[model samples]
Target chain A: MMDTEHLGTHISKQFNADLENLREEVLAMGGIVEEQITLALDAFTNNDSDIADKVIANEKMVNAKEMKIDEACTKVLAKRQPAAGDLRLIVTILKTITDLERMGDEAEKVARMAKAIANKEMAVANVKLHYGALLHLGNHVKKMLHDALDAFARMDVESAVNVAKLDNQADEEYNAISRQLITYMMEEPRRISEVLDFMWSARALERIGDHANNICEYVVYLVQGEDVRHKSWDEMQRLAKDE
Target chain B: MMDTEHLGTHISKQFNADLENLREEVLAMGGIVEEQITLALDAFTNNDSDIADKVIANEKMVNAKEMKIDEACTKVLAKRQPAAGDLRLIVTILKTITDLERMGDEAEKVARMAKAIANKEMAVANVKLHYGALLHLGNHVKKMLHDALDAFARMDVESAVNVAKLDNQADEEYNAISRQLITYMMEEPRRISEVLDFMWSARALERIGDHANNICEYVVYLVQGEDVRHKSWDEMQRLAKDE
Candidate 1:
């Protein structure tokens, strides 16, 4: 029989626990995205097409997990009719899952670019193409994603703000690598396809960094009810610290 | 004064109207994005950086509408404690506003690229770069976005599926333009930056098309409660029509 009265204002322990389970599911899916980014980056730097294939293969896992979490959150919303903070948590989960799914899509794009470049001469021309910088940028983006998920798990606004600050580094790294690669493309056209592929991979990482930053902003919104997208990094840090 | 009894499950008319208000707000935001895409495309084809500047300026309008709609949705979710279809509508709005905002960002990126290429001699060389193909692809994406929003407003599942199928044309257009531009870059290195700029604009439109497709998928979930992302386009078409 339906426990129709469970939707009342009195908090139910089972519902609260169910909410926690949803957050845990989000964290679990996030861990997989972290793995996808790491493997995809490894494939790029090592020219390991095998790992690239794995990244491609693992994308299905991310999509499946997203569907699962989304269904769980929707069920909770429809059944619980949760208010205030509980409502915020479920809504945030509903929104962030899409962001996380897009991050998976970006990682898959990077992996595909990696596979395309694996046998190319530019794979060996790492120095000529600033491949190390791209790797560094990719690694940094992966770390920010990890920390952002951790922040969400803990509802740690400070860590989330710090993640946004890290995006500046990602942006700088992307610009530096794009300029270097663009110059290379113009100066010497022999490895143009290979160089462009490397640039595309780096660009994908840069976008992933932006997505991670977006996730962090959502964390702030969930915790503080403030939209921080317009705030400067320093302002975001101060907001997190103040509360 | 607050409606104290709104906490109950009687389905208040005011609350229902408020939910309708939220959907109207989303539709309003959708209208702005449609304008942004149209202007951005005009900017690209005409090499009219001034129109591109207008699109950039309009980005703020889209952002403002998104923030307002988001805050309004969160308010309704927290206060009304809406269940079932009302709840789904709010959740979908929460998720889709982000997608619309990202579409606005992509339009802004295209506009910026247009401005960068406007005064260049290569702007006139768009004919050589398959700019018409990009324009056609972008127009298709805009139409899909328009139809997707219309489908969402009406909760029309069949139209949403049709919007997803249109993504195929966008993908083909993107590939055709990319392949043609890559050949041009290889054959003549003089206008490499211009050609690359064109490619980036086309790529941004393609991503916008994907975002539009994402919006349509959310509409299906809102209406049918079915997660259709995993389904093949053919399957999605069959499912939408079957229901």
Candidate 2:
């Protein structure tokens, strides 16, 4: 009986180690997802189909990584019967994979938009009003995604909350950009459809920011064991402030 | 030993029953979500705040139901260790909840837009092209969501594929509506912001259709255990055609 007990403990330790490795794998996948988004955006802004094609080619990697991570999660879930924190971690991996996969889809959309505009003459004249703002918003999104992943790695709720705050700034910038784009479209009716397509690309980037915010929410849940969703932005700010 | 064996069987049976109940609950939630979308469109078309208010109130119910379903899923997952088909069902519930919650958010957005336009004078020229196409698109969205949920509950993959096919029609209508709204904004620059706001409401409705398509995709997965996501519309159609 004592030998059996010792073997059981050893198996549990092995399982725990596998779970930690799975977590690292998921973070690696997240990093690739964020890079894909940034690359897809750059391809769009520069009108480079080669870069866009690269983004499309990389989606197979994303899909493959997602499946591998999912398999790891299910294996851990089935064999370990992880309770409490470990269970939550596995569940978060599963949820994050879905978000990451959708982000990949958004990136593909950006690439497709870029491909459509590849041969067209540059319409830089109308995009000037909000170029700085859009770039700022894009950088903010990159930071949010970066910091959120870092926070998840370190289990730092404070960093996660900070990432969530940046999402608001991104939102404001998106609104300003959209308003300016509408004005641009009105001024140049001939370019209406093309500009609208670009607006859709911007919207996709803004949505990626929202998904980053969602990842931060999951991080907060992981740390606090509480559901912070459905709360107002002001309330979330206050809570983060208290933290 | 006999007693322990009996207890195990009893637990398994109870767990299966709970899983079925959870699936039913999700379907019921889907029904309520679809209704909110339909009613919000009605409120927008007829300038009816009562229906808008009802949708807003129903959103609370949807939220509460989501929590209940989530709780049930957690309990089963923790205690039951469900495998194979049962495991797939639980994952489906989790994914479906996210879609349903998003649908609720879209409904709330539509209601808010309706309320904003409720007190205002209707458009001066009655925008014949905008409202006509939007009304038809809205009805199509309602039908698509209804059919998707039906396919989900019945595990009818063919029906789900059919519902998915309708998404293209909705997208076409959405594009037509957006062009009309843009034309209006161009004609009346002063009303640009308001027109843009109304356009977003229509956009949200279009997104609801997209989510319905996503649910149908999930149904296909449930039935065939295949991941058809990220495939081209033509490819998906081909697969369905072969069936």
Candidate 3:
């Protein structure tokens, strides 16, 4: 197994604190991103423009937090000049926050889709917009993101790989929703615009799942010093579990 | 202006060469990604599965190149212990590859869409899946990506900002195409699937523009040491030229 304790055993206590602080900041940012996804989904399912607006408003804070974490990472790299695991930790944080920021952007897109759909009522009175699958998919990805963040906080490579493996499930769920939406459009062509908007929101949720998987991969890399991206899931699971 | 010469004046000749080699790798990777977009678009416009297969095959190489550049950056950081401009260079390259790799994925999506559309021909007789706007948008983003890489190569903040401004134009083009496609779908409901596929290709092209803009933003950060993300184009231009 990797020497996980070495991450916190630097001769410079301040450097250790810097790394710890960076981790905390990332978890905090992840919390905001997770909340954004939840709210964006609630807005879509419940047709609540107020919740969507809140998500949009919170996006700026998310962006600011990303910039803050990035600057902190640069400061740590320049000042401490850490090597080995510490260096990997910083690199992983840099990459993780980029994914987090993109997750926030995806959440914003979901919110925008919600707003657009709310502003324009569905053309057909009886043809209700089906969102059961989207809600299920949203919850699945949200749980995956939460678990991925937990793995990051604990530096657990096995759990990280497991979360990464959830991506296939998310893709399947997304494909099912796409097929269902395509059927709806065919049945009632007048609702095509709104149905397309729903597809975009579902697409956004699927992308959030992707970003969460990326974070899990980065976690595995940070802990094990192995790059698991673009690898088959079987290979990733084997590598993560080998040691 | 920031001291551009500092990037090349490192005392260790090997360190300088390593940084130079890293830049070359990134540009080479960018070239491959650019070609992927061009080929993917050709595949879509011409309904040629052969070119689509070529783009799909090229994606593996793109992924491999990203991993190689990432490893090189990590090595440079661990060994050279670069700071300031050199550190930013490595960070910028890391971020650039991520965007470039994503651009490659978007290209692959376009190729997949082309294959899907070609396999199951459009349901309508005379609907004619339009390509005029999509071709224009594809070329616009391609040039934007090219200019963004040129800005990175020269570390020119001004050029980066100018290229970043083109994102608005790309967005406008995408919006126009989306509207036109919606009209076609409404006119011929049977062709909705094919029109939607066309919409996806256009969306993919628009995303490529966004990634190119992201790369330009990273160039500004690398050269000027300013995090200009989430800022207005006016602010980015002012910041890029202020010195």
Per-residue alpha-carbon lDDT of candidate 1 for residues A167-200, written as tens digits (9 for 90 to 100): 9989999988888877777766656777778788
Model 3, which residues run further than 4 Å from truth? A1-11, A123-129, B1-11, B123-129
- Per-model TM-score, in order, reads 0.92, 0.90, 0.93
Rank the candidate models, highest DockQ first: 3, 1, 2
Best by TM-score: 3
Model 3: chain A TM-score against the true structure: 0.93
lDDT of 1 at B184: 76
Clashing pairs in 2: none
lDDT of 1 at B178: 81
Better of 2 and 3 by lDDT: 3
Output the lDDT of residue A180, model 2: 81
Candidate 2 runs further than 4 Å off: A1-7, A237-243, B1-8, B122-128, B233-243
TM-score of 1: 0.92
| Lowest lDDT block of 10, candidate 1 chain A | A120-129
How many pairs of residues collide in each model?
Answer: 0, 0, 0
- What is every candidate's C-alpha DockQ against the true complex, given to 2 decimals? 0.58, 0.38, 0.62
DockQ computed for model 2 against the true two-chain complex using alpha carbons: 0.38
